[model samples]
Target chain A: MSIKTSILSSIGQKLLLATSGLIMFLLFLIPHMGGNVLFLFGPDMFNSYAHHLHQLVPIVIGIELLMLTSISVHMIMAFRVVLANRKAADKRHTLKSSKERSLAARLMPVSGIMIFIFIVKHLLDFKFYEKAKTTLHGVETYDVYAMVLSRFQGDPVHLVFYVLFMVAVGFHLSHALQSSIQTYGIYVPREGSKIKLISAVVGWGMAATFAIIPIFAFIK
Target chain B: MSKQINLTLKVWRQNRGEEGKFETYEAKNIDTDASFLEMLDVVNDELTLKGIEPIAFEHDCREGICGCCGSTVNGKTHGSHERTTLCQLHMRHFEDGQNVVIEPFRATAFPVIKDLIVDRSGLDEIIAEGGYVSVKTGNAPEASTTPIKKEMAEAAMDAAECIGCGACVAACPNGSAMLFTSAKVSQYALLPQGHPERAQRVKNMVAKMDELGFGNCSNEYECAVSCPKGIDVKNIARLNREFIKANLGKN
Candidate 1:
């Protein structure tokens, strides 16, 4: 099979999905979570961190393009693989039960769709939202800290929504992290796997870090 | 004397190309020592005397090696015993008043022919694809000539132990045959004799598997858990690597 034909194959499509997902996990989500942690240190640190990120315009644009491509491929392959799987399993038994499929694995597509919606809402709430200039460290910059505080401060609904979607993130990452390894042809033992531990830790840990922003902003 | 139990069986019943439904029957005087199939035999005998149609299911080797018999009992493929086939499951496992729900191994690829007997010709087709070696290495050579490593041989044998049963498909939520195909792929891929056709074999078999309306694996591990032979998903990981190597023009 050539590259094109293999890309069209079922396993090949899965390989593509795993690759794109890992790229986003490594490049995008990790850095985003890292930046989010600065929110805990106070307004200047957090706002400055956000402001300096705009200095790397070319690099950010390149990363954005890469992310755009990755997300598109991920969604497309997910659509095809899921639809094909459904078609193959059309005549399901009424009494079927799965003992080995984890809730995280079972809820992948659900969390995926939820996470997609969350990303759109998140970008609109922060990325695409207007950022007014403020004097910080004797330099004019976007007051992203104030923006976040104003959005979630005393707004229980928005705060809860942000925190709730993190669980969806947790669900997706917990499964995708280990699943990508298996798809790449690495054997993760069914029991006592360190990879499983790391997956859960990183998945929920990142979610917790992201969730803390809205929580602190809501309370403070 | 072994204990006898009376039970109710809700069995799926259907003819070829007909809509199916579950029919409940009382199985009285089931001996605990009897294998699940023998219990079914007793039920069939009773039904025959009563002029009712005997519930149709498949069985050849009552000991579980032939891969000729399988059915989902209460939603678990081959009942709830770990690594035990339906034929190997005994009546003693059931409670005295248990309600057993029996059904065919369901999959779009393995369509039910009648009652619990599904047409597993799809598996046969997958085997025919590349499950054999054709190097023309004439009459059986001495076993000592091959020089197979101990661990490698054991792993190959492990992969070779799969009986082509469709339990993996039935257990998979997506009706995937990945476990079955991976076992075949791993057995050959691990041995020296099968190296000559390695690249093409994985390619052909996977294509056939996908072409036959089997679902893609979702990394759920259900197929691994449901296999009566205790076939691990390690073979599946190897298969994914083998498929990549074969399809990536690495040959």
Candidate 2:
């Protein structure tokens, strides 16, 4: 890309990643999460469901690829925007001082990187390799579903990590989702307040949905 | 929770020029439900009927939509209430026999024009720099033609709600116009209508804001708190992002 195209495309890419990520989380991730917490329905039911999903190899692979690409684009654009913001701010201050960004806003880039890594690990452990599960009865069974459940029920460290990650995701989404929509310039005058409310609600849904998985496992 | 109140109003009084003084006036039997501007209106009416220069202040749209009514009332921009304009602030916030101090909105860019009216024309100039859609007529398309998502549309509108009030500058310790300018920049930059001149717009607006001598936004949240429109500081974050993208090159 030329300097001009890259600059414009960078903004375009950021908008795409942000808006897509928001929809993915709100419409897909939250509902998926509701179905993922299988302790209430027992391991057998959840395992069969997982097996059935695994049977759709091509479709699942396609989705995973699309998700990976989308997520990578989101992270790359996020870091670029954050760096550029800092640079612009520094120039304005001319080495005299710095602009004050909130702790939550400032932490977005760093927290985003962590969340990116955690997401990869999450997909691998639960959906891809079943790495969380090891040899079982000399059969090399990787009960992907059970591995996720075991983390909350048996592994305190994993449970804690899960909860912490969810909280970070909540904070990130609160700023990111609202900001991304703004960056893209899509709201109407009459609907502005409703969108703000929607942003908050989506943030809460992400936090609460992700939170439920760990809490249910830990308690039951 | 209502009560009759007596207030000692130390309002700024000046005939002309930079020289001015806080003249005390007793406003008795003040209704607690009355807005701060309304109370001032009552006082001004009394002054007007008495053949005096009715306290020489500025106000418009006492409904709080217009950003015209602004002053430093008791050390707070737009009065003590958070995210409120002077018109929205009611007397019930204060007690009877309380001393209320009212002064002009002080800032380098906002020079005092009269008793309470400050020259906010700087903001207008900054807006004129690139705060508009440059798309030519005859080829202009409908807004609905763009398939913008509901989420992005809302954010842009929120930023656009900023009524050109300099409260953000007044609230800033550095006297930064980032919040105000950013809101203007973001509203356009976020939309496709602003795409043609996006890079130049941000760069030019920032340059103008700086040329106008407004301070930097240090994220004090005071601007957000004091903003009658409640423009969030997140727009500043987006502004920083837009500035960076703009500086890289024009697309």
Candidate 3:
């Protein structure tokens, strides 16, 4: 089959989902997590990082556009795959699911929807919200660090919600990372595989790191 | 003497092209040693004696290898036993007074033919899409000359063990044939005989699978769990690799 038709096929759709998901995981999520780490270093480091990031407008715009495309593709592919699966599994036995199926794997779609909500709320609060003006490293830029603090500070409900959603992120990524590797046809051992362990670590690790900001802000 | 257990079985009943429903039957004095199919046989006999048509499930070769007997029992494909087919599933595994929900493997591609039998011809159609080495090797090459790596052969053999049972489809949330197709692809991809048609095989089989209205695998690994042969998801990874290699070769 040609590339055009191939991409529309069932296996092709999975390949698309895996590719788009990996794009987000690598280009956006990883860097996003790394930048989030700066918040823990106090306002100076965090504000300076944001200020420098704002200076790279062209690169940032380019990444944002790319991320837009990736997220769109990822969402579309997931939607299509889920619909097709629902159709294929038209009738289900009342009794379902082998115990061997992981809860993380089963909750993928649920976690996915939760993450999407988290992203929107996150972007609205941080990306779109106006930050107080600040001079950082001799440049006037948004006080992104302060903005993050204000959002999470003294709001127990907000802190709890943030942490809860991080658990959702953990669930989604734990399965997604390894599943994507397998979809790419890498030989990850089936039983007791180190790749599975690493995937879970990276998944929960990022979630924990991201959650730390809200938690620390709430306490401080 | 083997102990006996009674089970309350809620078996799905339907006519061809008709909507199915659960019809419960009481199976008393079932010997624990009796296979699941034999338990059904006893149930069928009672139904026949009552002047009612028996549960119209399918079975052959009472052994697990025929891939003939399969049903979703308690929501698990092939009765939820790891690496066990329905025919090999014994009554001993069931608890007395337990309620068993038995139904056909449900998938859009796998239409219910009767009570517990589904038309699994879709699997055969997928196999037809190039699950073979069409290019005949003129003669059997010397085993020494072949130099097949033991690991590769073992993997190939593992894949080839797939009996084309529809259990994987039944277990999958998406009803995807990925595991089955991957196994077929891997069986050929790993063997030298399959080298000649390697690229074409993957491309064609994948194309057919898509064309047949099967769902894409979301990497749930449910299929591997339901497979009586214990087929691993690694074959699917191999299939993906083969697909990429095949497409790249064409380009």
Candidate 4:
């Protein structure tokens, strides 16, 4: 009856999660993907892109807050749904077998938690870290691109971590995309296969594109 | 008529609202062509002759149309066969000297009445919330009165195939009835007759489902897989959409 109670219902919570997740993907992930492409174009272009982003301080801060809010909402709803689902089935099955569910679907919560950790670490290392000294003509410049390059190229551990996180992203997105579509009730029976295929393609594409940047940074 | 087989059945036995356990029973010389329920009948006959308590289960049509008879066989709701109810599952699917595990549908809402018989009246209560269209009592309208699209009618029929068996809840690890709820919602949501009450129908049904202790669908899709009617998980999505539309007053 009330708006809050209506949204807090099991299905309502899921819808909220799906809707927020899609918005996060569009607002944060797509732009992040586009920006990561700059890594391939050498340090100058990448640094300039980073600088341009910094130039729009107010807008950037607003977008960052919005992204944070989206992630927080998505995560809270997910946790509630998980708790409700657990409570609903208090008795665990002795023999567990799920043949129809996709691996990505099964691994959603696990991958989600991992992705949360990765996002926090990523922000701390790249966004929050400030003192990167690059000396050009005996003058030190706070170099964003140089910082990224050093983090990826200098540390094999960081590279591996980045790649692993991308894989987790792939797992989450593969299920999330089609799930979001379904949650929004956009399914046509005839296009079911196509929807699944597209979700897979987009998920893997985003992951691969993001993952390739760290690999290219190390190798090149 | 196939060769007869003997099966060691591990059937769940419990009294009303009490702790239950698996009670082993030997079903000997069972006809391979006989239905799974028929095999159970043979076992029950042996138990009765031995002055032991017979296994209690539910059945009506024995033709798969009635949703009454449902048991988890070897951790599979409605037996191991896809889209097949327990009454329709033949004994030929099993091997000689096999160990078959039969249990009642487990869910908070569907408490076991006794043995394999569970009180699935929770499903009926969910239906009663809003599973129908209101119509005045009168002569039936002409068949061609409302022109529905071929695809829409087919999709609606696909959803309407749900027999209201608690297989979806039983098969689900989370015991979610989203599949059943979605199927019922979609059946009417797809038809024009169901239009007037579409918003209210989904809202009430979903509310009752959650209120009755059915789990939220985590997209595990086990419900869809174990459903006797082969109901699509897409219906769950449609239910989500309908719920959103209803809440937003768009419907």
Candidate 5:
């Protein structure tokens, strides 16, 4: 009984990870964009919203932990599947052949890893560092929202990195969503066509939403 | 209106095994109403008249049903149109002065046997590796007894239409046989007759597909795109799920 469910669970696990990953990405992005809209009220309002999150420290910490775990599991499973495919393909030919799959599917693992690295840097810059240490402006616990925006605006380095990271995220979601649907057994022509369309729209939406924040931050 | 169209053909020529090169020929004014394969017939007839060996290619039903006339024409499989096969491809798609590049199917498993003809037995090898309904025919109950849903039946039929041509493998950059083998597996797996060997079938077929020097399905779907019979990539997806379930010891 235990083995049976676990076996079934492995198949579900990948779909679950992908579904939850996509949800969390969209959830965080939508609200994050909404919060950025507060920038229209000036940097102070944005800074104050960041302070409110700090005040709700317990809830913030809890959500952070959950997000971290979800992300880790998703990344691990995705990487495992990618590695398995690589090994499976390699064992067959022995001689390396050029990519025979679509460009999107072929580069999924590399793109995913890049997005993962970007996420880590993102957390360190805005979330952890600001929470752990004082800012150079002599403010304790940091003015994270402002600090982030200022980095994008004044630092060309940060702006370029953010844009590149968003592009990677877009491509990752585009391929992952389409392939994940296929992975889960929804491959009929009609459904497959719908999935492809939805994946493209969602992927572009994610990249655009993320890009909006950086663009606004740069200008303001 | 069937306008007369003059076209130059650049076709891959090979006398025998493994070695082949492209040879160019000027096809005189031909009726644009002819099917792409019919146009090829004209060239072959002219070659025979001149005592030159006619180009060798494979085709069975010219109705796009046999899946035998698989080739890359002008860089697209089965000609430029989507969901169209070579026999179904008409000369109307080409311009008068256009140069058509005709080549044999290319893949590690599909070795070229002659000019524009490849040995696609790799597909059969994968299929035989376990792409079947193992249930004994006489011992089985009535077909209506199982009562499968109409949708599933239709989907199974769609997959079953795959004629084991290696066009999907040729179109795919990775030479993945996932579409071909998976469609075969899914066609049977989707049906009631497929129940007995469900687990073993997917496992054996997938393993065989990989062992035959085919690439893993990355879901680029070029296989579905170039399939002359329009075998959907969904079959490949179903195959993936079936394999994962089998590997994990689930039915």
Candidate 6:
């Protein structure tokens, strides 16, 4: 079979999705979290961080390309698998029970879609928006901290949307964390519950920390 | 005398290649000690006595070992109790004057053959693909010669408990057979005898399962819950791991 068809097959699609998701979580998520945390350190720290990131244009572009590719692969594979799963089962159960399935597991696709939208909107607001810049020490750099505060401080709707998206990210990661491990075949039966708990904590923790940044920006 | 309960059964009836509907039947005075299949037999006997066609369901062993008997009772596969097959579920679990709805295991892959009977040969086709060890007969070592760890043995045995029953597919919302296929893969993957052809075995079997119209697993653990053998869903994870490992270097 051709490599493309092989990867499109059931098991292959899942492997690609899980691997890409884990990679994005490691490379993109960690750096994004670090940058957002700089918001709490006040304007100079956050703006200087943005200025430093701007200086490494080539490296930033490389990482951005990789992130785009990873996100595309992950989303495409997920959609194919979900659609195939729906087509495979032609009937629905009249009486259903959720004793085994978690809410996060069931809502993965929904949360994924939300996260996708949030990512695009976030990029538009912070990365591509042509806002006025402030010159610091005779160097013109984008005032990212001011832009963030302006977006949240006076706009309740924007703040709510951001917080809601963060919640969606939390739900998505709760399942994805443990699921990625399973895809890699690292399951220890005795530690199943422990793994699930850890996944939940990490997922919610990342989401909460990110959400707190905007809320803090608005209130401060 | 055993306590007897009368039940109202709404059993699905359909002929080969025909549309089916529910036909209500009254099963009166069934012994609480009777197996679920036996209770169905009692209903069929009454229908026969009334000069009416009896219900058609599949069953060979009254004992639960044979995977022949399966029916969705009250929206639960093999009945409401967990880990109990249709043949082993006792009538005592039901109250008098209760209503039970029975239907065939519904899936695109598992078509209705008759009342409460479905064609599960698709599962057999998956097993036929690569679900066996092909070691030479004379080269087989004595059982004691193979020193398997206790934990691994127990895990293998747990996976081996899968009776090839299609309950996993029936119970799943997506009708995925990943649990059943994964259990088979795990059973052999854990044993040394199955090491030689591990790569081909998982690859061929998974391809066949997908080809046979089984859905992809979306991490819903319903299959494990509905399994009569209580086969763990972790096997599915292991199957994924094996699939990735098998195809690591190849294009």
The prediction achieving the highest lDDT against the true structure is 1
Best by DockQ: 3
- Angstrom error of the Cα, residue B39, model 5: value is 3.1
Off by over 4 Å in 3: B137-145
Error at B184, model 2, angstroms? 0.5
A1-220 per-residue lDDT for model 3 (tens digits): 7988778887778888889889888989899898889989999999888877878899999999999998899899899888888898886857477655789988988999999999999888778887799886787878887788889888899999899999999999999998888888897766788998999999999999989989999888
What is the docking quality class of candidate 1?
medium
Candidate 3 has which clashing residue pairs, if any? A95-B75, A96-B75
Which pairs, if any, clash in model 4? none
Give DockQ: model 5: 0.19
What TM-score number comes out for model 5? 0.74
Better of 2 and 3 by lDDT: 3
Worst 10 residues of 4 chain A by lDDT: A133-142
Tens-place lDDT per residue, model 2, A67-91, is: 6677766676666555444432221
DockQ-better candidate, 2 vs 6: 6
Itemize residue pairs with steric clashes in candidate 1: none
Cα error, candidate 6, residue B82 (Å):
1.9
Given candidate 4, what's the lDDT at residue B249?
Answer: 98
lDDT, candidate 5, B1-251, per-residue tens: 89989899999887655457888887777788999888889999999998988989899998877878878787677777878888888888888898988887777677778888887887888878787665545775765788999999999999999887777777766577878888888888888778778888877776666556665555676777677777877787788778767767787
DockQ values of all predictions: 0.69, 0.02, 0.70, 0.50, 0.19, 0.53
Per-residue lDDT tens digits for candidate 2, residues B100-209, read 88877767677777888878898998899999997767975886788887778898999999997788777665566778888999898778788898888877777777
TM-score between model 6 and native: 0.94
Candidate 4: where are CA atoms >4 Å away?
A133-141, A188-192, B142-150
RMSD of 4: 2.3
Provide TM-scores for the models.
0.97, 0.54, 0.95, 0.94, 0.74, 0.94
Instruction: Give model 2's docking category.
Output: incorrect
Candidate closer to the true structure by DockQ (higher is better), 1 or 3: 3
Every candidate's lDDT? 0.90, 0.70, 0.88, 0.87, 0.73, 0.87
